[model samples]
Target: MSAPVRADALATLTAWRPADPGQRALREAFLGFLAARPDSCARSCEPGHLTASALVLDATGDQVLLTLHPRVGAWLQLGGHCESTDATLAGAALREATEESGIEGLTIDPVPLHVDVHPITCSLGVPTRHFDVRFLVRAPAGARETRSEESLDLRWWPLDAPPDHELDDLLAAAQIAR
Candidate 1:
């Protein structure tokens, strides 16, 4: 995107300090990535790029919406890489959540709830790391979700009992946000 957008993302990351030791390490690593690469926020930064994800909770706060990601073949949060139009990392998370969930008027907590860096083999057979900045977003009550092409299925699961994999970070974010 524009220089200012990337700068804003960097500023957001710079301002955050996670309580969890492991998460703090990831955040520090993310700051290093930004310092090393000016284009780190761009999807075209093949070495590794930035992504934004949302741990979305329904209005009642007891349930979470998850997407069974087609490529990853796992139930995961609503999120994707940054776009040219995304002004901030939090905005990117909200856009991805709304687009994937098909729910309107979703509100996001401006501050990030978690940060993670993970490796993935892209569709183009390129290895990349996703420096995912995770935000807590809320969907309106009774909002219906439509399945997007990116997901095998879209469903809401109880926060008290989430899917077996990748629940820890999501649960932690939910708890902290509340």
Candidate 2:
């Protein structure tokens, strides 16, 4: 990623103060990650890397778009690892949302909606942690979604009552976004 993109991510994280103890710990950890590696956001970063993701809401904000991730086999919001072309974490989230959702003109809330650190076994058999910075993205009215190759299926789900076990963080992020 470019210097400006790195700077943007740093700036955003620096300004964020999480409301809860768990989130506060995540913020500190993310800051540490940024300090430890300038290319922390890059997918190639060994051991762990940063990722950008979104809780994508429909135009009315009553529904959310989710993808059944092929690898994880779970319904998740659109997102992925940062790309060299991304100029900001928000940009990365937006790009991932647009690409995965196959929808254009999606508007993203600049402030981060959530932060999480999770372990994953990559395709190459390497274990890594994804320090995910999450944002809230709003889709345009009458938007139609197409499934990307990364997903087994893509669908819109009611925001008021999401699947309890699978989307606890997403539901919490929705509350934070609102």
Q: Which stretches in model 2 have alpha-carbon errors above 4 Å?
A: none
TM-score of each: 0.95, 0.94
Global lDDT of each candidate: 0.86, 0.86
Number of clashing residue pairs, candidate 2: 0
Error of 2 at 61 (Å): 1.0
lDDT of 2: 0.86
Candidate 1 on 40-158: residue-level lDDT in tens?
88878888888999988999988889999887888889999888888888888999999999899999988889887888875537888888888999988788999888899999999
Clashes of each: 0, 0
lDDT of 2 by residue, 23-137 (tens): 8888998998898998787777777888899889999888989999888888888999888888899999999999999998999988888898889875536888898899999
Query: How much does candidate 2 score in TM-score?
Result: 0.94
After superposition on all C-alphas, the RMSD of every candidate to the true structure, in Å, is 1.2, 1.4
